[model samples]
Target chain A: MRFGVVRFPGSNCEQDIVIACRYLGIDVDYVWHGDTDITGFDAIVLPGGFSYGDYIRTGAVARFSPVMGEVVRFAERGGPVLGVCNGFQILTEAHMLPGAMLRNRGLKFICETVPLRLERTVCQWVDLPEGTVVRIPINHNEGNFTADAETLARLDANGQVVLSYCEPDGTRAPGGSAPNGSANDIAGICNERGNVFGLMPHPERVVDPEASGTDGQPFLTTIVARLAGV
Target chain B: MARYEIFVTYKQGIFDPPGATAERALANLGYDEIESVKIGKYIRVEVADGPNERARVAEMCDKLLANPVIEEYRIVDAEGAVSAR
Candidate 1:
């Protein structure tokens, strides 16, 4: 299957995602944020970055980019989409997913490989046993996930919440280890439809320990397996 | 001319970090009377006079200007831009 990695004007993780897909034996290409056509790919990856300088808000500007038009269309058609870090912000801004992102509670940039607990397995991209922990790198200033009480309740009831922050020692992290202070330690979530997934952690950066860490292989391999009909 | 006012505020459950920071500042000044604070975004737009102008601007605000998931916005005024206020 062909994997398309979107490239916004300030996207910094496009190459990293592409490399991860390549390692999985899937051909990858760069889809410019200005392009509105996504006909040649089976799945799309919105990589992390400070698009539009994170002005006004993290994903506010990038959500209006020319390419997002296609992304929205792709999502409506049930095409698989994965958003990481700032990509998560863009997805929320585009209304492809529920909730919005705000500045980190500590009000500072955080960069580190953090542990996350798998919470939902209904998503096609998720194949891990529930409670499995993965260490993924997350670097951002605006990564807090927020939603109204009703919406949050709906998401929980629908099993849209995919992951939660965990301590390096494999236990729940109260506050500091959670990084952005997201409610309920949420680290990732998917839309009710389950075709789109968005999370603040950078799985691509963790595919190789030498490059960052090797905690991202499971996610990548899971996607590859799905596309390969395994 | 047609006019519209949009009131966007943080969704009820999501913590407003910026708003919290502001609240902390208020408390630091010994202003103990304040109960809580929530920051929000507001936009006022004026358009050509038309029957549907108000609805149109509200739609734009919902689809583009404000995100419904984490914020709620209402069109408070739509009467022709009356006496700049």
Candidate 2:
């Protein structure tokens, strides 16, 4: 299966995504932000890093990149789209996903491995069952997810909340559960149609033990399997 | 050409971390009775004068300058006449 990773002028993690895909034996190509075509790729990944120097706002400028128009069209045609970290921010800005990111609750940049729980949903990217916990690292200064009360309720009922922050033992405390103060401890979400998935953690950075650990392998392999029709 | 100032602030009930930090710092400096402080963005824009100029800028704010989900914006022209959303 071929995966196309979009590289904005300032994207720093596109190479890591290329590495992760290569490790899995998946053919991957770099899709420049200025390019408008995405004809052959089976999946599109918007990797992390400060795009457009995060000017105006994180992902705000990058959302208007020429490639985004093609990406949106691909998504409308049921192609799977994954946005990680700053890529997640761009998804929100482009209105492909719900909610905007506010500054982290602690008002500081955070970089650490946090336990993430998968909630079974319609997302094809995550094949893990509900309530599965994995260790993935999140690094961001503005990752707090904010949405209206009714929208949060709608997302939960529809099973669009794909992943969430949780305690190491797969449990959650009553208060302050999310490290970044995301509403309902939400770490990631998918669109209602279940084709677009966006998350704040860096799965590409943890695809193998050499990169730290292998907890992030399953998330990648499942989608690779889906695209390969395996 | 016309110049305008736009103020963007988080909507009510949304947490403002930077504003809260500043509020706490003020109290530590001996002002205990401070009610609250809000932090927001102040933007200046220059647009060529035309009909419906204020409305056009408001559209820009809705589309890009401000996130309507979390923040509200107000525009003030050179004459200080205010238009808010």
Candidate 3:
């Protein structure tokens, strides 16, 4: 399968995502933020980075990129779209999801490998059993997800929440688990249709066992299996 | 000319660590009298019309300036200066 990794002006993780895609045996290419056409790819991944220098807000300015229009069209056509970190911020800004990430309450740039519990794994890129715990790296200061009560309820009822930080033993990891103060401890979410996924964790940075942390391999492998029908 | 004020703040469910920390600091500073401290953003705009313009400005807050999910904005229109809600 062909996978396209979007490279915004300040995207720092595109190469990492590209490497992960290639390791999965998928044809990978770079899709510039200025390029509006999202053709020639079965899936697209918006890697993490400080796009637009995070001027107004993290991912706020990047949401207005020329390629975002096509990315929206791509999602509507049922193409897979995954946004990480600032990419998640952009998706929220674009209204592809119903929320926003604000500055971290601690007012510090946090970076570390965080444990994430698999909330719902039936989506296209993931197939693990529900409630599984996986470690993924998260590095961002504005990863707090906030939404209205009704909207949070809707997301909960629809099972749109996909992943959350959890303890290794499977119990809900509180406080420390949430590097940022997101509502409901939400680390990741998928669109109502389940085609578009957004998360604050950097799975690409942990694709291989020796690369950084092997904990993130299953996520990429899940998508690989979906592509290979394995 | 008429004036309008816009207020923005975190939604209910979000954890306001800074606010909590500020409250803690205040308590440590012998200001235990305060209950909570919530950070907020305010914007003021000048327009010609009254209520109609206020509504338009509110819509702008929803569509562009403020994120409705984590933010609630109140607009007040006045003859010269408006106050934020």
Q: Pick the candidate with the highest DockQ.
A: 2
- What DockQ values do the models have? 0.53, 0.73, 0.41
Expressed as tens digits, the lDDT of each residue in A5-100 for candidate 1 is 899888998998898877767789999888878899888888899898886578888999998899989889988899999889999998898878
Instruction: Report the C-alpha lDDT of model 3 over A28-92, residue by residue, as the tens digit.
Output: 99998999887888888888999989864677777779999999999998888889888888899
Top model number, lDDT: 2
Q: lDDT scores for all predictions?
A: 0.81, 0.90, 0.79
The alpha-carbon interface RMSD of model 3 comes to: 2.3
Candidates 1 and 3 compared: the better one by TM-score is: 1
Docking tier of model 1: it is: medium
Prediction-by-prediction clash tally: 0, 0, 0
Candidate 3: where are CA atoms >4 Å away? A173-176, A227-230, B1-7, B11-14, B42-60, B74-85
Q: How should the candidates be ordered by DockQ, best one leading? A: 2, 1, 3
Best by TM-score: 2
Interface RMSD against the true structure, candidate 2: 0.8
* Model 3: how far residue A41 lies from native, Å: 1.8
